[model samples]
Structure formats: structure tokens, C-alpha cells
Target: MPLRAEGLGKTFRSARGAAVRALDGIDLSIAPGEFVSILGPSGCGKSTLLAILAGLDKATQGAAVVGGKPVTAPLVDAGVMFQRDLLLDWHTCEDNILMQFKMRGQPTAPHRDRARELLALVGMESAAQRYPRELSGGMRQRVAICRALVHEPPLLFLDEPFGALDALTRENLNTELAALTAHSGATVVFVTHGIDEAVFLGDRAVVMSARPGRIIADVRIDLPHPRGAHIRELPEFTAYTARLRKLLAHDGRPDHREGVRP
Candidate 1:
């Protein structure tokens, strides 16, 4: 489904009763089946924007529309993944994914085969019976992805899902995610601080400014799909990353730039 944010703005009151603006005059449209990466400074409201788009939170002003309807509540057809795995410690890996179905009052048995297939896609099939406590950080995140995807939602939101992993693991999962989503025909909005990651995963990398975030640049990534790790070595990939870094550096404050590096 396509997503549209019209004149979107968000404001929050601080503990001392001060109004803090997070997003302002943000107008964005994401086409169906498009993977758009939102890159911005640390406090630039990236996560807040994702929340509004996913209908998890309401915009202080304007509206968030999905398909042809205005979003007023959490979308039943949307799936969300966060930096933390948020898996149940007592549940096994496969069970964690099945929990998604159970939460919706759906039958888990019908989805079991697909859940195993997703685990196999992430090379976690052997770990299906392993508890979250027994799995590594990356493994847990893999299960999180499966859980988010098992429902076959047309839209997926990921908020720095790989941000907490080690360098090598992060890269590996990035590649896997690219490959996994290539043919799934799902529209994805990925929010991240990593410039390379934004370039690597996004069809278009939308750069946002600091606090009271507004989009400053939207650069289309020209690289081919089904991108592997080797795609990162391409000159085009480097150029996209470089351009994003420069955009962030020019639009972001010195302290904010620290969170935007590759």
C-alpha cells in the first residue's frame, strides 16, 4: 500500500512543561512496494515519523493516509520491528514468530510452515527450538524479522532494527534483508543513522534535518536489486553514501552528525 503524510507535524511537552517540536511541515509520499530508507540525525524524529506513518501515534497536525483512507489507529495490516528483538524470553524461536498469529486470534498451525521457511531464509531453521536466552543478539533479531513478516503484511516499518548488532553481523543481516524483501512485494520504511545502510537498503534515501525534522533531500539509489554485500563495493554505492553523508553534514549540527556516519 502507498503511504502519504500531508503537512505532518508533531509536538511534545517536556517534563518541565515546555513544547518541543519534533517534526514540522513534513510532506512525504511513498509509492506501493517501494523501500524507502529515512536517514537523519539522532534526535531528528525519525522514529516518531515512522510511528505516525504506521498509525501507532497520531500527528499533532495534518494527517497520515495509507492507501485511500486516513489512518486513525494502529493499522492491522502493518508490521513493525524495532532495534530491540522484544522476543519473549520463555518462547522458543519458532514460537516467537507464531506468537504474532496468536495475538491476532488466528490459527498458528496454518502459519507454521511459512514461519519455518522464513527461519530457513535467515539461516535460523536449526535454531527454531532455541529459546531467546540461548540465541545471540543477531539470532534474536532474525526471529524478530520472521515474526514481523510471517503475517505477510503489505507494509513493514523497521526502526534501526540492525543498529544494535556487531559490524559483521549487521552487514550480513542487511544483505539477507535485501534479498528477503526483494520478491515479497512489501513496501518498507526503514529508519536508520547509518548512511551506508540507508543507501544499501533503500530505493530512495530520504534525508531529514535535525530537531523539528523536515526532509531536506530525497535521493534515489540507482543500484540494482537483490543486492549482495558486493554491491556495497560498487562505485555507485559509494557515491550514494557519500552524497547522503554530505547532505547530513550540511543540514545537521556538529553534534548531530556523529550519529549519521557510515
Candidate 2:
């Protein structure tokens, strides 16, 4: 499903009645099956913009629509994954994947096969019987990703899902996730600080300005798909990364915490 936003604005009142503008006049469009990664500084409204579109919050001005429907409340057609795995400590991985269906009051039998298949794709089939406590951080996140996609939602939102992992592990998950998102054919809005990860997974990268966030630049990734470690060594990869770095380093305040989540 396509996503469209127009003149979107969000404002929050401070403790002392000070109004803080988080997002202002943001216009964005994401086509079906396109993965767009959002990169920005901490105070920037990366998560806030997502919240409005995902129906986690309301927009102060303008409107956000998914598949032509206004996002005034939580939509069942969308799935969200956060930085934390949020897996249930007691439920088995299989149950965790089925949890979404159960919560939706939808039949679980129809999606059981898909749940198992997604687990195998991430090489976690053998661990399906294990609980979250029995798995490592990487394993837990793999399940989280599966849980998010189990229902086959057309629109997916992920906020720094791999931020807590080590570099090597994060890279591995990034590769797996890109492949999975492709296979599932979901239009994704992924917010991340890692420029390489952003470019690696997205069809396009959207860079946001500082506070009162608005898109500052949009860079298309013409690199090859099913991208591996070797792709990073290519000149195009370096050029894209360098361009994003230059954009983030503007105004004498280099966004050193680009990899840090808000």
C-alpha cells in the first residue's frame, strides 16, 4: 500500500507550557513495496513522524494516509517493530508469532505455516520451541522481525530495531531483514542512524533536519539488490555513504550520534 503525507505538523507543549514543534510541513510519499529509511539527529522527529503515520499518535496539522485511508487511529493493516524485542518471556517462539493473530481475533491456523517458514528463513526454526529467555539478543530480534511480518501487513514501521546489537550481528540482521522485507513485499518505513544500514536496506534514504524535523535530502540507492558485504566495497556504496555523511555533518554540528537512538 502507498503512503502519503501533506503539510504534516506535530507540536507538543513543554512542562512550563512551552510549545515545541517536533515536525513541521513535512511532505512525503512512499510507494508500495518500497523501503524508505529515515536518517536524522536524535532530537529530530524521526519517531514522531512514524507515530503519526502508524496511528500511534495524531497529527497536529495536515494528514497522513495509507492506501488512501486517513490514519486517525491504529490501523490493522500496519505492523511496527521497536528497538526492543518485546518478546514474551513465557511464550514459545511459535506462540509469539501467532500472538498477533490471537490479539486481532483472527484465526491462527491459517498463518501457522507462514510463522514456521519465517522462522526457518532466519535460521531460527530449531529454536521455535524455546522461550525468549532461552535465546540470545540476536535470536530474540529475529523472532521479533518474524512477529512483525507474520500477518502480512502491507505497511511496516521499524524504529532502530537493530540499534542494540553489535556491529557484526547488526549487519547480519540487516542483510536478513532486507531479504525478508523483499520476500514479503511490504512497504517499509525504517528509521535508523546508521547511514550504511539506511542505504543498504532502503530503495531511497530520507535525511531529516534537526529539531522541527523536515526532510532535508532524498537520495536514491541505485546499488544492486541482495546486497552483501562486497557491495560495501564498491565505489557507488562509498559515494552514497560519503554524500550522506557530508549532509549529516553540516552546520558545524556533525551528528556524531547518528547511530544513537533518541
Candidate 3:
């Protein structure tokens, strides 16, 4: 198995006695080296699902299995990135990237070299010695990408990693990230609210319904990879996005299926 979630569900108690259901019966299987994106509206449990998948939080209800084993806690094999790079302001970019190794308390010679290569991979090798304050927003995100890949994780979980950037910058990074994920052969589960971004980066965009979030649409992008910049200008891209929008516009919820206890 690459990463599989079976009957995943979560309910949290608020200040009041009532409970809020964040996710409901989310069953997803990401094949090894595939790129998949989770798309949903705000407060639709996209991040909550990502947290569960990343092993940062446990599902109140199901099981997550990775590489044929159950995911009981955070797994080092999957790297994670969020909206913010969250680099230490005082540390040089290279040092900040290397922090992943320090956190794991693992030996670093080979991984350190790999980190530098990752920096270069994102076109930030020259900024390796510079501090976060010295880099622009896009550059900081580039460093974040390098940091996420430094450990050479077989899987990557990204939660709105480009949500804060300007449109042009976000587009640029989207292209770069697609290329990098392809080059590295890492399976990716990305979360985003932007439909265009979902279409551009994901091999298939999985759309979730509002509130008690669950998969509502699984739209495949049939375009070839190493996708050229002009691919988005094609009619097929617009058609797929329009179809997803139409599906989401409908009010139906996912059918409850029987599975192992969550």
C-alpha cells in the first residue's frame, strides 16, 4: 500500500455540549507515486482530513495504513508542508531546511547533501546561506518545498501550500511543484480550495461536499504530464473544471457505506 484511509471520520466537542462532525466516511487510496488533490470549501474538513492522513491527528473513527502497515503516529516517510513555510527567521535557509533532520535525531551527512540538492532543485541553491528575512515570499515557499523534500519522503502531504501567494507566484510554484513531484516520484496528497490549482497540479482532483465533508467528485485530468504551460489554455481544462463545478453545485451527499469501525 502507498497510503490508504478506510472509513475515516472525526467528531470534536466544541465549547457547547454538541459535537461537530468534521469528516465522514472518507475512504481514499493513493497509489504509490501518484499526485492527488483534495478540493473543498473553507471549513469543509479539508485540513482535518489532511491532518489525519499526515498522522498529526488521529481519526476519531478509522484506520490509516501506509506501505502495508497501520499508521499509529506521525510517519517519517511522508513529508508535510502548510500555508506558511514557518522557517526560523534567524537561521540560514540551508540551516532551516536541515532542521528536519535535527527533529528526527537522525544522522545527516547523506541527508544534508540531499537537502542542498533539494534547495538546488527549487532554484534556491544560491540562497542557501541567506536568512528567511532575505528571501521574498515566493523564495521562502521554495525553501519550504526544499525542506519538505529534504528527508526524501516517499509521500508528501500539502495543505494549501500556496494559498497566501499572489496569483502569478502561485501559478509559477504550481508548475514547479508539479514538475518536482513528477521528477522525484513522490506520491502527493494536496489540499486546496482553488479549482484551477486543483486542475493544474493534480492527476485527479477529489472534491468534497460542504459541512460533513465527503468525496463528491473524483475528476481525472487526462492531460499528459510534464504538462506544458499552455495546457491550461486548452478547452479540455476548462471543460473538466466546469464539470466539477456543476457536480459540486448539486446538493447530494455521499452514500454511507459499511466498513471497519472508524
Candidate 4:
């Protein structure tokens, strides 16, 4: 169930009839049940690579394979979540989560039990009847996460899922997400701009270059899993963050959004 990319590249026809290369010769592999974070500057095509891997779009060149099968179109073997929760405005939390089941054509009875279990896992059983408008940003994101996992796909692609939350809530949710992934034993490909977040959650972190994107550095985070919040206070954490800062700053502009509070 590994995700593999070989000589992956992407291009687009611009409005003016010029070809623009977004990703360039990217090569990487993510093992089953591993957590890998892709970090880079805003326009570096990190999201583009993610889209190709999730089979949302076709790669202009090279290959991407998941679970030993070539990815042609959107594959059901993986799940994707983005920064926006994308919850239905009027649907109750549980109903919104159920939509995932409907999309995948999964049987209702088993997933119904699974959905309620996920809600309980996220400690949101109390809010199961609430609408998105009634929940706080953090709670809504939690519900979104529950929706993402309802189908129990082996691989999950998260594109800055915590990017919009407040500092405290984001930190708390990071802890929750790490624990949830551990319990589920699902492989993850997480995209983030926060070095601390990457260091905390990733088993391996892939840093990409500026436009005409390519992988520049691949650092393995040797930290033990169930990486508790307390680990952030240790020297290893500080050193790891400092190293990432140095790498991100190598090109004059760092790999991050300015004024990012999370």
C-alpha cells in the first residue's frame, strides 16, 4: 500500500499559449502506515504534487502508483482533506460525515457504526446533532476529519488541515490527529507550512524548492511516535526546527506564509 512517484513532472498550458512547468522530476516514496510531510514555499507546487498523487489530476509525465496499482483517476484507496472543512452548511455533523459514505457507495450499516465511533473518537458525540454554523472552527475541523476517516482509506492526504485554526486549537488538534493516526495505523501525506508542525507530526519531511519545483532535502524525523507535546520543549525539537528554518531560508524567502500564527 505504498505510494510511489517516479520522475513525476507536471505542466500546464497558460492562458497565453505557453507551457508552464509546475513540478519537475519529482521522485519519492511513502511506505505503508508512514507519515510524510511535504513542506515548501507557497508557489512551489506542493499541492500540485499532492493532487497528482490523489489522482485528482493526471501527471503530464512520469508515474504515480498506490497499492501497487497505477493511478489513473481519483482512487478510492486514499482520502484527501484540505484546509477548508467543506462541510454542508445545513447538515448536522453526523449527516455531513455520512456524505463520505454516500460518495464511496459504502454500505450504510457498518459505516453508520463507524461514523458514530469516529464522532466519539473525536470527542464530538455531543455535537453530532449540531450544524457547522454552531460549531467552533476547531470543532468543525474535527468533524471534517471524522468525515475524512469514515471510509477508512489506507492513505490520507491532508493539505494544511489545521492551517485556519487558532493557535491553541491548532496545537490541541495536532495532538489529537497524531494520536488518531497512530490508533488507525493509516499512512499519511500531510502538507504544511509550519516547520514545528512538520517536525511534530512527520516520520519523514520532504522540503521542496521554489517554482519549477523539485525536492531539495529529505529529512527523517527520528523522534518516537506518540510524540507528546512535552517533546517540543526538548533540545532535539529545537534543533530540528532550527535545521528546517535554515533549509527553508536557504533561498532568501523561507518556505512559509508570513504572519502564519499556527
Which prediction has the highest TM-score against the true structure?
A: 1
Ranked candidates (lDDT, high to low): 1, 2, 4, 3
lDDT string, candidate 1, 241-262, tens digits:
8899999988754566577979
Clashing pairs in 3: 61-262, 62-262
Q: Could you give me the TM-score of model 4 versus the true structure?
A: 0.93
Candidate 1 TM-score versus the reference: 0.95
**153-218: candidate 4 lDDT, tens digit per residue:** 789999999999988888878888898888878989999998999999999989988887889899
Candidate 4: where is the Cα deviation over 4 Å? Answer: 252-262
**Whole-model Cα lDDT of every candidate shown, in order:** 0.92, 0.90, 0.85, 0.88
RMSD (Cα, Å) for all candidates, in order, is 4.4, 5.1, 5.7, 5.4
Q: Each prediction's TM-score against the native? A: 0.95, 0.93, 0.91, 0.93
lDDT of 3 by residue, 1-262 (tens): 2888899998988998799998889898889988998887778898998888888988998877888787889887788999988989999998888888888887666677777888887788899889999889999999999888877789899999998899988888888888888888999999987778888888888988887888887877887778657878989989978877776666245445546477
Better of 3 and 4 by lDDT: 4
Misplaced by over 4 Å in model 2 are: 251-262
